[model samples]
Target: MSVFSARTGLAAALAVAALASGGCTQLRSHQGYVVDTDLVNSVQPGVDNRQSVLATLGKPTLAGQFDQGDWYYLARDSRNLAFRNPRPNAQITLQISFDQKGTVTAIRRGGLDQVASIKPYGKKTPTLGRERGFFQDLFGNIGTVGAAGAGGGAGNGSNTGGGGRDRP
Candidate 1:
């Protein structure tokens, strides 16, 4: 083969290799919280109080809505490949509830099974108002332009004194 043809064949092989490598999916990692099983296991119900739980597991991720006695520690790990959306691989939610006296009443844990997917209903919301056509909107105020100010002689050229009162 000629040198020019050999060089062209090498270039084509390199281009094919580059395209094949580009199609490979890369794993993307996402971690919400650092999960420490020892710290979570140390927290005990009825024995551990609010202050003790805070001292053991540090601060919680979220507090209960409407009630201040509930503390929630959330940890999640999601993985995404290529341009697709990230999917949750693992999730841990530790919910610690306190009684009225600030003592730990219940301790619960959840995983990825509790995850819920929510989809939006529509693109635009329906509003309550009058809908007009193109011509109606363009020439809507033609006939009713001076209807309101007609009785006051404002738009009928009757009061053309530049809106200044006569100084005596």
Candidate 2:
């Protein structure tokens, strides 16, 4: 075979291989805090306070929402193939509880087992009030605005006719 035809065949093979491998590639992502194993383990309860912990591990990913005493550091590594949702391969959730005096009281660690997946029921959220169609909603208040017992009537009820004074 001539060198030009051979090179064309080789280029076609490489192109096909590139397209095939593209779908097999794994995409990885990291979210939230970046953790250091030694630094996280180095934090000792009763010895480290909020300031010391901040200096050691930097700021936490999230702090206590309500109590303001607990700090949480989260690190997650997720991977996914083409056209697929990313799944967590590894996750670290470190919770450091502090006392009212801002001293570290306890340290807790969690993993992927703690992750919860929540799916909503449907596309449209169910509401409490009566369901009205397009025409009903558009013309729902047609006669209710100035009706007799509904107020705003013409000089009939005490609420509609009287202008800041009581009439006997």
Top candidate by TM-score: 2
Off by over 4 Å in 2: 1-17, 20-24, 128-130, 152-168
lDDT string, candidate 1, 14-125, tens digits: 9999988786666657565577899889888889999999899888898887675599898888877677878888899999999888899899999999999887778966
Ten contiguous residues with the weakest lDDT in model 1: 150-159
lDDT tens string, model 2, 18-129?
Answer: 9999889999999999888899999999999999999999988888877756899999999999989899999999999998888999999999999888889899899999
- The alpha-carbon lDDT assigned to residue 73 of candidate 2 equals 94
Q: Any residue pairs clashing in model 1, and if so which?
A: none
TM accuracy, model 2? 0.75
After TM-score superposition, the amount by which residue 63's alpha carbon in candidate 1 deviates from its true location, in angstroms, is: 1.4
RMSD of model 1 against the true structure? 5.8
**After superposition, candidate 1 runs with Cα above 4 Å error:** 1-23, 126-168
